[model samples]
Target chain A: MTVELASIEGQRPDGQEREQDLSKSPLSIRGLTVTYGEKPAVFSVDMTVQPGQMTAIIGPNGAGKSTMLKAALGIVPPVSGRVQVFGRPLEEQRARIAYVPQRASVDWDFPTRVIDVVLMGLYRELGLLSRIRGEHKARAQECLERVGMADFAERQIGQLSGGQQQRVFLARALAQGADLYLLDEPFAGVDAATEKAIISVLKSLRAAGKTVVVVHHDLATVAEYFDNVFLINTRRVAEGPVAEAFTEATLQAAYGGRLATTQVSQLAHKA
Target chain B: MSGEEFVPLSLTPLLIGVFAAVACALPGNFLLLRRQALIGDAISHVVLPGIVVAFLISGAISAGPMMLGAAGAAVVAVVLIEAIRRLGRIEPGAAMGVVFTTMFAGGVLLLEQTDTSTVHLDVEHALYGNLESLIWLDAIGWSSLLDAEALSNLPVELPRMALTLVGVCLFIAVFWRALKISTFDEGFARTMGIRTNALGLGLVITAAVAAVAAFDAVGSIIVIAMFICPPAAARMMTNRLEAQIGWSVGFAVIAAVVGYVLAGYGPLWLGQQDAVSAAGMIATISGLILALAAVFGPCRSRAGAPAGV
Candidate 1:
């Protein structure tokens, strides 16, 4: 189920190519760079996320994986670059994309129930002056059920376990009704069962022709879960089919001295 | 201490406390949810200078000018905090501390320069409000036919403070779900197209309006007590946002009544020469309630502490 880096080169399935239709480019990035004040986190990253694909951006710690995702969403203003979603600029297409920030980024103890959190995904559709109506509540409940969280709708978000919280977030994303989904470290703290649940949802999203871009840490599951992979450090290490682009050489380049080349090569061979 | 002395339906303080409690609690819920609880304290304190400056310019403590001054100062405090956070690379607490302390000090200095004997900017008076005086204040006139009848009878007119508080509370009640969603998960809110920033600013403005309404009755220092205490206490007793709001209003009304009655009768009952201030007593009671909640409230789960932990 794994993809070896060396075998991926030219064998990238035609289905995996970035959709050629200009009208279908769900996300486009050109020379995107993100810096924290003075320190550069992601430098010169170029990527195009197209419809009907699961794009996993993979890298070692401090490789700017999350930064690239944030930059693409305009959450972090890129130092120098442009990002477009569905041929429109980020702000123009904000409603068409949903973002799930790292779970750690928010305050868990905040006084909000799971249903309330899920209803947040309906805000853009509902607008500010309007309230969440009966239909919105029904939709929220349906989304919660999709993620196996319907029973927990009335529970406070802080009361949920880690895996349950992750499911709740996924449910919120499901309720967003966006064309593009951006998830930062969705699998970081989850159990194997939770991972399976997440993968199934992502697969369904791709099956439905939506675009999914995830910041992933686990190399073993990349090929099994994603159609394409973007290997990144401070710069674009490589990007293509999971089998060809995610090689020992690319992993070494992206991870630097942290991961041994032989270990990556073996993992690639095993794929 | 006869039962006759305690009128459950007293028109003045009861109505005033009910309105004020609802208004303050509505915005207070958002503030607590946003973890910006202390911003209320900062705005209340900084507005002192704005009030003094407005009084000096207008030569009178008109409600309109004083409210504008206080709101302007609140905006200034927010801007200052934002600037300090940006320029100094300081934490939010540090930034808020710098802004509130500087503005409060400036207000005190300005008050000292004015004719203190005639234009008294008493710190004690500002911190806790004189709720008893609100009973003597004129009632506001509403344009409706029913309101005209209510006004013509001079039937123990509802104090202006109570009306203002009730209006604000109604606004919060109407937007309760939106505020809760925005406060809890802003990123999701933005994605859902909630105009998260506008909602955030609205919450801040609501806090400012509540603080201003409370300033004349409770004084600036203790206004924060009303803004924070009821919400804090309610947080412990409920998991639902609606329940929290209800509990906060309930707690606030109870505290106000007990504080008012105790301050009015404490000296006579204890045979003490000095009577306690009602505003001071209200704030003290609120603080006690908050303290009790903090100590006895169910402990928040420590599992899955964020990455940096």
Candidate 2:
């Protein structure tokens, strides 16, 4: 089903005001090449994520969208590239960047509670071995409430549904108090209601002037959900405003022959 | 033995067992949580070669030389495991199996060359241990603790195990937050400047030390059992890290006390005169406790706990 594009800044009407500011973009990757053993996952990809916007990195399966994000977060060491957050190297600007790995990356059955996971966001703020005072607990509860998980704070993480798990992760990112959030496949396996909630949260994040870069797969809602779209296969194909840059031609280039069938089905359904 | 004579003998072994149990189980929780429980088993096996080699070089069976050798062997064992994991491209479990078995075999071969006829250095002592033999007989009564001569006769194992447990408690206390965060999520902890690699390496080293410290009193089997079982059982009881650790230590101490008494009296209960090996009994009790927890503990349904979150 088509999603509502009314709230999304699909094309910047005040284009002059949104001029490319390399120093101000929340995230910028230059010549980022990530290799897995002998094979390259992402090759010399260069992209910038503007602040105060929701950017979607979209492509087919095995398109290195997650790899690019992992490289930028330093989870996977880039073979050759530099990642900058707010015009500084990732290491220098680490405090301002928050990353949410794939929901499947962590063990859901780990012996930990919902509050413990959220409190991890405050590890840097609390420092080592210091007691988590009431103020810190209050902040974590506030973040959990933002994602509608305040009621489930005491539940074991494994008890949560996939959508609830996604919300918990989003709450954790909110607790991080970072200027930029990088989410990898957050919408995967989530219910429609969770998707709406997540989008609303993303909209709020943008409203608060925080940047969010999400690795998304559903091409139908890319324009509707995000202000900017970055299209890639192994290499970056195109990137900019969704209306201008996310064309059928670019989708075909990113997905090869797979896009043509999907386009035809959409056209058939529309007719 | 009369009840009067049983007092001092039981107290010393009981204390030693408690110390060993507490020491091993403290770090055991972290090891189990980190999905490196086998490393405790590996370190225990690998330290045998170190202790044997140190005996050959120092030509003495003193604690200092033995500790040095055990520490050296434990470090080398970890390095070899990592080397095999990275260079040999082997999975961690297989690599641990390869290094520990080989090093332990080498230790056995070396032990054959050295004279192990002495009670303290006997090969049997390495496996079964001699908790019953650790009696402070000279300390005739509680007042003997005030007598320097009587106190001097106390088994070194008692003090050594006690000190190790104290040290482990302090280490876990001081680094609680770092350990919890790093164990929960290493990559994110790294991004938060946790020095995750150093914290992880430090944890492995601490486990090695605990295994080595408990090695002489409880033997490797008991050390391995204490390392895995109490923590595994405790994990089945609670989801909070602090509570899990507390439960693990509590379970460990309980197992130690009950196991020591059972080792001494279980045969009597069976209408036999001979007591069982205290180390074997301790390990067996730990297994029983684990089974009980798995069946009836609050979090038993989530027992698998899934390695590497």
Candidate 3:
């Protein structure tokens, strides 16, 4: 599997011109460091997400996986770093990107309907006056259909189950119609049906040539879910196709002694 | 109440109270749903110091300088609260508690030390504003409604409050979607280029302007009450933002009109001589409305939770 990964990576022409005049990685971060107080939260980490690929960033607890993602998007200010999307500054290219944050980051009990939550994705086009015509509602409804949440459009958000909430968030991301999708823990705490629904939607997104980067756990699903993987603790561990980068050595380095030997052995044997 | 008497004594103050209630309640809906209801409380408390400082600097009770001073104090309080929360690594609730309490106490001290006796400024007046005294001096009867001279002689608070309401309405109308989106999910709002931080500050500032304007006409008590009670009661009645806003405005109008009338006439009917404080009565009525909604509103309980919240 590892050899196959290396060969597939080698086969890429490496400059497909992508959506830009010059081919560039969809996301590129260099020497990024973020700090909360005295101690650094995420060190001088670097990562590159190639265009039109499903990539995963994996690490142990408190490994700053979420922080790194946040820094790339400027959600949390980085102490020292530079990030680019499609080879330009993030701010300039923000409209071309979509983000799905963790469910816990928001107040679920907020007064809104599911359709309204999805409609927020079109805020850029709607602008100040937002004389929302039927077309915007139709678009939101279509996004909800993509995530199998069409029937839940009129439902109050607070009444949703955890899995249903996750689907609604995915539907919102889909409504953005963006070229690049960055999701933080889209699968955490979701049920199996939701997991399958999310993956299928993500696969369709990739099939349509959109770039996807997810901060993922559940190592058992990594081989099946992602083609590209980046392992990190405070800094980059290894990054490449999952078959090549999802090695025992990289896992051990990322998780340290905190990872059990049997778990590592099972993952190795599973691969 | 005869039209001859009511037109002169009650019309202007009633309009001021209603305007004040609606203005504060409009933003209160968002703040309450965002779990930032206490921001209104904090802003109202800090406005006292702003008023006192305005008087000290300009040595006048004019509206413009007082409004500016109140706005300045509100900004300072917001900055101080954020500084304490970030620098001290303290939770927001505690930081807000510290800042607002200390600022309010300082305002009381300043009020005592300063010779504000010549003006209508005092701690008691600040808490329970002289809502009753804001009467139309030139109003004669129903004809006054159409008489430009009578209208010109209307209390200054009437127009000032109307303008404040218009400002609040315009802000909400222009930024409705952004405010709704950011209040729900700030991260997603940021990702969408919504300027969540600026919008958050803008929201607080809007609340501050409403608080300062309302505080001048009604008092801190009604400002605080209108900020929390109307929106909270409205929250109990619905799950939709539009519906919640509508209900809140309705509730505010009810509290203002009903509370003012009850304060003015209920005692008269009970064989009493003077009316009670309109500010305190409005606050009390709004609280009562909140209590009734809490117990009986259909959407009051947490979704899928047992019996009571």
Judging by TM-score against the true structure, name the best candidate.
3
Identify the runs in model 1 with alpha carbons over 4 angstroms from their true place: A1-23, A129-135, B1-14, B71-92, B116-120, B137-163, B170-175, B292-309
Scored against the native two-chain complex, candidate 3 gets a DockQ of 0.56
Query: A94 in model 2: Cα distance from truth in Å?
Result: 2.5
Q: State the lDDT of candidate 1 residue by residue for B1-309, as single tens digits.
A: 322232222345545655665567668877887888876787787788888778888887667888888877877887999999999999988998888889888887877777645533465556665556544222332222235553454323235565677667666766665676767766655544456687788777777777777776567645678789999888887776777888788888877877777777778789987668777777778788778877776633333355566
In CAPRI terms, where does candidate 1 land? acceptable
lDDT of 2 by residue, A1-271 (tens): 0112311434331233223322266888999999998999999999989778999998889889998988888877889998887655677667777777778877676778888899889877787667899998898999899888899999988888888888988888888998788999999999999899989998998898889999998877876888898988989999998776777667767888876767834622432
**What C-alpha lDDT do the candidate models reach, one value each?**
0.75, 0.82, 0.89
Model 2 chain B: lowest-lDDT 10 consecutive positions? B300-309
Give the C-alpha miss distance for residue A162 in model 3, angstroms. 0.3
Alpha-carbon error at B177 in model 3, in Å?
0.6
Q: lDDT tens digits, residues A165-260, model 3?
A: 999999988888988999999999999999999999999999998899999988999988998999989888989998788888888889989879
Those runs of model 2 whose alpha carbons end farther than 4 Å from true positions after fitting are: A1-23, A261-271, B1-7, B74-92, B146-149, B303-309
Evaluation by lDDT, superior candidate among 2 and 3: 3
Q: Could you tell which candidate, 2 or 3, scores higher by DockQ?
A: 3
What TM-score does chain A of each model score against the native chain A?
A: 0.90, 0.88, 0.92
Model 2 agreement with the true structure over B1-309: per-residue lDDT tens digits: 654476578888988888888888888888887888877888888999999888888887667888899989877987998999999998988998898999998888888777876546656777777788888988777777688998888988888888888888888888888888778777667667778788888887777777877877767878889889999999999877789988998999889999998999999999999999988898899899999999999986653244463
Question: What is the DockQ for all candidates, taken in turn?
Answer: 0.35, 0.34, 0.56
Instruction: Give the DockQ-based CAPRI class for model 3.
Output: medium
